[model samples]
Structure formats: C-alpha cells, structure tokens
Target chain A: MEKEQQKRAIEALLFLSEEPVKTDKVAAALSTTSVEAEKMIEELQEELSAQGRGLQIFEAAGGYQMGTRPDLSSFLEKAFSEEVSSNLSTAALEVLAIVAYKQPVTRIEIESIRGVRSQHVLDNLLKRKLIKISGRKEGPGRPLLYVTTADFLKYFGLKDLGELPELEVENEGAE
Target chain B: MVEQAEYKIKLPTFEGPFDLLFHLIKKAEVDIWQVSIADITEQYLAYLQSMKELNLEIASEFLVMAATLLRLKSKLLLPRSPKFQEQDEEEELFEINTAEELFQRLEEYRAFKKAALHLRQKEEEQKKVFLRSTGGQKIMVFTQQESVYTIWEGAHHLSEIMQRFAKIAAQREYVPAFSAVEDFVIARKADYIYAVLRQKRRSVPMKDFVIESSLWEVIITFIALLEMSRQRKVNLLQDRPFEPILVSLIEKQPELFQPEEGESGERTAKESY
Candidate 1:
C-alpha cells in the first residue's frame, strides 16, 4: 500500500477499535513489521494533534486509541450531554484507590487498612468490573486477591497504572 | 436527642466509625497521635448513643471500634508507673500493639482518602475527553484548536502491569484470537431497539430484535429490553411462559435517550505527516 493509503488503513483499524489497538494488530493488518507500525502510529499521533483535529489519537493502556480532544469537551457536551459523565460515590472512590495502589491485594488487607468491613463495597466493585478476583492467596482460607481492571483505567482516563499519582505516606517508615 | 439526629443527617460523609472518630479528632484540633483518648471516646460513645436513640441499626464494625476505644480509654485511667515511662524506644514499640495500632490504621485510612480525592480529580479531568462508540460511531463534526493539550504518564514500577499486557508486549506475534470486547456492543443493541420501535409504532416481538440469533445476542437484547423497560421507555409483556416477549414503547416519552445526530461543518484542513 502507498504510505498515504497505509495511513488511511491504519486509521480505519484505530477507528474500529473501541479499546487500545496494539501496534502488532496494526502491523498484522498492514503486512508490516511491528516496529514500522509503531513508528507510523507515533507519526500519525503527532499529525493528528498538529492539525488540531477534533478527533485525537493517544497512547493509553499501552496501546493506541482515537478520542475527542479534551479541550473541545464543551462543544461536544451539548450533543453528547447525557452520556457525558457518571460520578462515583466517595465510598467507591476510596475502595478503588486502595485496590489501584495495592492491587492483587486481598479484601482482608483492604479491610484491615480501612478498619472497616468492605465485603459489600468489594462486591459492588466486582459487579461494575472495576475490580476482579485475580487469584487466591496462599494462606489460611485462601482468600481471593483483587486487582483493578482495564475498565478502571478507562474510567479514570489513565494510560496505565503508572499514570496514577504517587501516594504520599508521611509516616511510611513508622516502626 | 434532637441534636444527635441533626448531626446524623448532616454527616452522611461518615461511612463508618473510623470516619466519625477521625471527625471528632479533627473537630478537637488534636493530632491523631496527641488526641486525649478519653475525650474522643466520650464523644464516640455519645454519637453511638444518639444512633441508638435514632433507631439506626449500628453495624458490628462500629461496635467493635467502640469496644476498642473503651479499652484504650481504660488504659488512660491506669496510674502510670515512673518506671514504665522510663522504658526505651523498644518498649514503646511494643506498647504500640495496644494504643498506637489504632492511630496507625487511622493514618493509613487518611492517606487512602487523600488518594481518593486525587483520583476524583483525575476522573474529572478525563471527563473532558470523550470516546467514540464502536461500529456505528459517527465522525462528522470537525473541531480546530491552536494550543496543544498533552497528558504525560507518571513513573511507576514497570514490572506491575496487567497479565494481558505482558502477553501482548512479550510475544509481538501472538495476535489475540479475537478483538477484546468493549461495553459498546450492548449499547448498540439498545439503540437498535429504539430505532425499531420508532419506525413500527406498535408492539414488536423481542425475538425480532435479536439479529444474529446467537445466544449472546439474545441475552444482550434481553438486557437492553430490561433497561428500557426500567426507564419507562418500553414495556415487555409475555402472555405465557416460554412465549416471545412483546415490546412496545410507553406513550409518554421521558425526554431521555435521544439519539444524537452527526453535524456537518467546515472540514478542518489536515497537514500530512
């Protein structure tokens, strides 16, 4: 394919993808190597934003995604107002913060840290697919370990868990 | 009694006993380590008494914390031996099992609560950027801007990533057998039902909405119907068991679920990379 045609084909794949499109997927579809595909992706990302296009491409969750410009949210709000937002309760956010930082952590660990019962909150997070049962711990009763989901990253607009702000623990070294 | 009821109504922010205890300590303007246990214990008991008077069923977690506070309060009542105070830092660390443990937990909760606020900010900031739906996503409107908005990722332990990511990143050739499913498919099905009801203007069999006839599509359509019914947009009726459900729109529209139209505008010029 011509370089121009290749860009168009790559754009179609990105558009079709609701989740992050891996570079390898784009490479396989284009019959190109993954390195070249990643380079093209990087170039296209710069081109899209350089033109200040309404539709923007970004690298998130270790893959590429096409989304609306954050600054242009006001203009799109009138048309997409109803689906614009769904704010979570404080309790949900607290539970999510714990699960995000100490992920693959168990419910007992979360409850002990909070000094409260978290079974109900954990169940709700599991239902929402914000957190999942990663595996069972190797200990008494073999309690299930929980970890944040991709949806959790999407919900928080994070590219990865690495994007989460560093948690400051003032007395972290307390004996 | 009236005051306690008022306080209970006003303090919905307190999700549990620790939250209430934290609130009392803050109100006293005392650091968690410095708070006089007796004062906070009395206040915590007072709040529990009010909860009892108001007939609120206190969860055992709150009661457990109450018992804990009372035990700590009794320690304050004990006469301090001079020798006990003269003990070194090692002894103080052991003493932490009884008293400082509660403070440590409270401090940990405070850190997580602060982290939650930071996450809330991230959520709000991300809300400014919207995503396109899969399949029927419209790309008609064009927006142009001069200044660039960039969000950079922070540093974290690289070893920590999803199992899925490790597989994809390590073996570049391993194409996922299928495209990972996003939540938009169900939303699309829901929209399809709206279009069908608008055109027919009569009760339609639910099975007619199932396009692929796959078990997955059947369940997806059924869930969409349930949601629409809950929102009073549609009513599902089945005259007999195992009968096809008849779905019809409610007469009064609730001014919701309006389908968005793609607007045409001057195309923003795109420069070649």
Candidate 2:
C-alpha cells in the first residue's frame, strides 16, 4: 500500500510541476530514498503508458516532467493555436553562425568577421535565447563572450558542439 | 547565305559612361577643371547612338547621367553677366564636382566588395580547421534509460565546485564576478553527460542544479567526464539527445568512483559520484 502511494505521489509530482522535477527532490518531498522513488516512478511511468494518455513523463535538464507525447504533437499544435516562427534575416543568420562556430568569442571578433555593426543582430539572438553572453573576455574593454544555447542545439537538431559542421579552408591562396 | 553581307559595321562599346568621358578627356588632354562641355557631350551622344544600334538594354540610370552631363554642358556654354558669374562660381564648381562624388562612392563599393570576399575566404579557412578537429569523433551518446537523479547529481556537483572557485576568485581584486552556473552548465551539456556516465550507472535526471558554478571547476568537471566516456568507464542514456543525457557508471572502473569534489578539496562520498 505504501509503495502504491509512493507511485501515485511520483505521478502527481510529474503532473503538477511546470518544469522537470528532480528525483532527489521528489524523494525528499515524499520522505523516501531516491532509489525507492526511482522504482516507483518507473512503475508509474509504465502505468501512465498503459493508460494511453496524451501526457508522458520524460527527463530533461536532470529532472522528470510530464510532457505531451511526440505522437500527439500535431493535435497539440492545433490546440495551442499558434505556430512558433523563427524567421531570422540573412544578417542575423550570419551573426548566429559566427557565434556558434567561434563560441566564447567577443563582439569585436564577430564584427571583424561580418565587417558591419552586429549589435542589433546580437541583441535579437540574445532576446530569442538562441545565443547568450557566456561571460566577459579578459581584455582592455572586458568584451562579453557569446555562445549558442541549448535551445539552439535543439532547434538545429545537434547533440553537442562537436556535431556542428566542420569548417574547412579549401584554397589558402584565395585567402 | 547570311554570311554574304559584305560590309559589317563594327560598333565601339565604352566600358561605361565614365570610361567614355575619361577617354575623351585623355584625347583632348584638357584639364577636368576646365573641360569643354560641348565637345564631351557630342562624344557621349555618339557613344549612346552606337549602343542603341547594338540593341543592348540601356538602363535609365545611364541615360540620367547622360542628361546630367548635357545640362552641365548647356550651363557652361551660356554667357552670363559678370556679376552673376562671380556670384555663382562656387555653385558652378559644386555642379562640376558632382561626378566626383559618384566616383568616390563607386570606389567605396569596390573596397567593401573586396573586404567581403576576403572575409569569406578567411571564414572558409577557419571552417576547414574546425572540421578537421571534429572529424570522425562520435562523441554524442543518446539513450532512453536516463533518470533525473543522475543529471541532478552531476549538475549539482559541478555547480558546487564552480561556486567555491568563484568565491575564492572573487577575493582577488582583478577578477570579475563569477559567471552564473547556468551559463557553464547549459553550454557544457555534453560534458555534463560525460561526467554522469563516468559513474557505472547509466542514467541521470534533468534539472537546474547547475545555477552557479566557477569557470575552472566547470572545465575540469567537463574534461573528467570526456576522459571517462572515452575510456568506456561509463555509459550515457537519454530518451533523446538534447533532452537529459543520463550517465551510468559501469562496475569495472572503480577509479571512476571518486566522490564529488567539495569546497575544500574534501570528497562528499555519500552524496557524490
């Protein structure tokens, strides 16, 4: 009976949380060990799957959250009544590509490559959370370093930085 | 039979109106400051007539420039009152010098084009280097068995180390405030996965445990994860690649069992890797 309650608690936690909930936090909240919570969560996951519900539990950012099942994306899209559009202009795309390739790079470096003021483009990418200011570089002006975000990887279908296309110089003479 | 036309009229094509003007100026050997407008206008029209016969698509911009030259020529040809001429000398000079601005703008455009080409070449070169370095490295590990607990633990460990380092670094006057742990945590996601996998366990959770971390510690943690993954000391699992990559330590590699490093270099065995 206690085990069944713990399983229900895991299900409840997964349902109520807005963000992915860590197992440790869930275990602590339910006054149980993480190992026990893991087992219960697994059982609850199977039960939820067996019910053929629209929602399914998935791990993200080191926690479990109840999210819409992938198979039901089309139905969810209709229900949401909005399409997410990412219409980046050529200039914005160029800036984003530069940041992705030479990450932890400064604005000056980005400008040098683009040969134009990238302030507006950088601002837009930052606003969209596609790229972010990783930190400031140690220099005279302390320029901020830019890097691509997790959303960027997810959007581009990349697993990691190493997955980014290799840049190659074919003709040294032309340069 | 078409080849039987005995006389073929050869038409002269100037590179552009500017080229024709330069040619006329050179032939006349006249100073541009005191150019004879009537003579240049005649030469320009002749070139335009020749272009018309060739059935080439004459752009309006070229014709507009021709009209401008004609207007300037007409003004230079008319005799003016001494007082009026004296009063309008600056205006006349400005009118004559309008072509100079066009020439300058063209020069600037050429320079910009050259610079863009050079930049593209440089970028291509840089891309080559990037590709060479990343070649044949199947570093990304995706699995379905990942749990939230492992991801949280890994992020938490890295965050604690980063916070401690940030605190120590902050004591020095020159160092800037430490970056938010979120910055390093999100950026080094692959490393996080690698770290979790270093343990014999194959799954971890996904969470925000990496909110505040120092730079050096984050790098070290990331490297440790990579080293372990490379050694096959652990395996990573996740439902999807970008979701939460869970790491499980394989039981054989006991050295991979070092506890999470704490603020004072002490290991938190009960709560760590």
Candidate 3:
C-alpha cells in the first residue's frame, strides 16, 4: 500500500479505537513490519502536528492514542461543556505518588511513609480507577499490594512509569 | 525552656504531620543533620499548640508525633554516663534513633512530594488533551479474556453474568418426584445426555445435564457419564473448586463408549417393561 493510504488507514484506526492501539496491530492491518508501522506512526504524528490539527497522537502505556492538544483543554471544555473535572486533593496526590513510585507496595508501607493513615485515600484512588489492588504481598496477614493503572498514566500524561522524574540517590538510599 | 517555646507561624497547607516537619526543616534553612533536635521539637510542639488553639481537627497521628518528639526531647536533655548502654524502651518501638529516623522520613516524603508536583503538572497538561468521547462509535466487544481498562469492571461484569445464570437456574422448576423406580429409563436418559453433548460440541455443565425427576434416573445418567469419561469419549473439567463440573467430548475420538448393540437392545427392551 502507498504511504499516504497507510497513514490514512492508521489515522482512521486510531480515531475509531476506544483504547490504545498497538503497533503490531497496525502493522498487521497495513501488511508491514512493526518497525515500518512505527515509522509510519511517527510520520503521521509529524503530519498531524504540521497541519496544526486539534488532535495529537500521543504514545503512552505501550501504545498510541489520538487525543486533543493538551493546552486546548479549556477551550474544548467551553466548546463541549461537559462537567468533567478530575481535581484531586493533596492527600490523594501524595498517596498516588507513593503508589506510583513504590508500586506493588502495601497500605502499611504508604502509611508508614506518610506518618498517617491513608486507607480512605487509597479507597478514593481505587474508586477513581487511578490505582488498583495488583496482588497481595506474601507474609503475615497477606496485605494487599497497590499499583497504578493505565488510567493513572493517562491522567498524568505519562508515557509510562519511566516518565516519572528521577529520584535523588540520597532520598532513595534513605529507604 | 520548653514552656517558653512559641511559634508565630500559622501553617495553612501542610497535608500531615510529616509534611509540617518537612516545612519546618526547610524553613529553618539549616542542614537537617546539623539542626538541634531540642529546638525543632519545641517548635513542633508549639505548632501543635497553635493547631489546638485554632480548633483544627488534628488527627491522632499528629498527637502520636507530639508524644514521640517529647520523648526525643527528654532523651536529649538526659546526662549520658560513660558506661550507658542503649536500652530498649517499654513499648513496642522499632530502632530508637528517634530524631534521626524522623529526619529520614521527612526527607523521603519531600522527595515523593517533588515527584507529585511533577506529576501534578503533567496531569494539568493531559487534562487539556481529551480523547473523542466513546459515542457514535461501534464499541469493540471483548469476548476473549484479556485485561480490560479496569479489573473491577471485569469482575462486575462477571458478577452480573453469574446473577443472570442463577436467575435462569432458579427459573428451572424442580423436577417432580417419580411414581416408581421402574419409571426411570437409564439407557434412554444416557443417550439423551450424549446427544446433547454432541449437539453443543462444547462443555456442558453437570447441573444442566441432570434435569430429571427420579433420583434413580439421575444416578444412572451420572454413572453413564463416568463410564463415557473412563472410555475417553468425554472429558470432565472442573476449572475451579466448587465450580460446576463441565463435560466435553474428546474431538479426535469419534467412537463413543457404546454398551454393545445387543446389550443396549436388551436394556432398552427391559426399560420398556
């Protein structure tokens, strides 16, 4: 298939997909290698950006998604006017940070670090689909371990956990 | 000196006691290692007093820290003898470097707080970039088991399916008791089960297989299923403990565990009587 046709096909697929679309799926659809498909995606992203389109192709959580430009949110909200606000409190933010960094960590661990009970804060995060009970740590009482979800990455505009800022060695060594 | 300690500071934005400690350390502009524990403890207590005066809803954790700081302050004031050994406290306390441990915890929290601020910025930026709402688009149905957006949603879906199944199962009227044992036709009942399995070409639950009235008939059908399983005509799968036992055909094995033609003929003849 021609590059133009492939780009259009990729664009259509991304627009239609409700979830992130993987490169392999795009490659299979285009009858091209995954590497070739990745190049196509990059080219498509450049084309879209060059065009100054309202939608931007964002790579996150092991796949790609087409979303509105990040800075255009206020204008989009005014245009669409849906009551959507994800304002999280400071306590919630702190708990989320601990979970994001020390994922598969237990509630007790988060509590110990915060020097306060974070049970309700964890419940709120769980309700919001920001964090999930990944599994239970193997030990006495088998406390549930928490991990951030893909929604967490999306909410934070992070491509993955690696996108988080590097922690100082002195800070990390204190643990 | 402890009673004389008064902090004019009014902290409006500390998330918790540790956060307050972090602020105090930072505001003092002294290296945490070099700061005097007695002065820090006094200031911390004074802040706690201010919180009490302002009628703030102080959490128990704050009070606990107050007790800890008081203990550390008392320990700091004590005269150390040359032969003094570090004795364990009366309560269940971890290692006793109270001041040092508090400092370390405050540092750790500050690092995460910085990370949180970075994430907060990202979140603000991402909030502007919105996806097209999942409207007017054909929803992709996920039949094959894969991780969906949220496991909770998957679990909730499973529970709804389970409830529907239970409702259907409950709707199945109880089989009326038989008039006599001779009313049970074992050969025909077994054949019916085998035919159903063949028609479905998939695992059929044991509960769905035995919708008969008589106990003897159900027993005979169960025995027949066991015999078929033994002969490799059908495979029994119990996916989990307490789940329904599922019966499936061995696809490669075309021949069923047939009681010899004459034997089934004779059993049918006897069943007719």
Per-residue lDDT of candidate 1, residues A88-164 (tens digit) = 88788888999999988998788776666788999998999989999999999999999999888877777899988
| Candidate 2 off by > 4 Å | A35-52, A83-102, A111-117, A148-175, B1-273
User: What CAPRI class is candidate 3?
Assistant: acceptable
What ranges in model 3 sit over 4 Å off?
A169-175, B1-11, B81-85, B90-96, B140-273
Give the lDDT of residue B41 in candidate 2.
79
**CA lDDT of each candidate?**
0.74, 0.56, 0.75
Whole-model alpha-carbon lDDT for candidate 1: 0.74
Task: Decide which is better by DockQ, 1 or 3.
Answer: 3
Candidate 2 docking band? incorrect
TM-score of chain A of 2: 0.64
lDDT of 3 by residue, A1-175 (tens): 8988999999999988766788999999999999999999999899889999888898877788899887787797898776568578888998999999998899998988888789999999999999999999999999999999998887777778998888642543355
lDDT of 2 by residue, A1-175 (tens): 4877878877877776654577899999899888888777777778778999776765544566666666665565465544334345555666766677778888877665543456888898899887999889997999999998865654443445665455442321223
lDDT of 3 by residue, B130-223 (tens): 8865543354334323312344444555788678756755776654434444324545665677778889988898777777544445556666
Arrange candidates by TM-score, descending.
3, 1, 2
lDDT of 2 by residue, B181-229 (tens): 4344333554455454454343554332233464544454445455446
Best by TM-score: 3
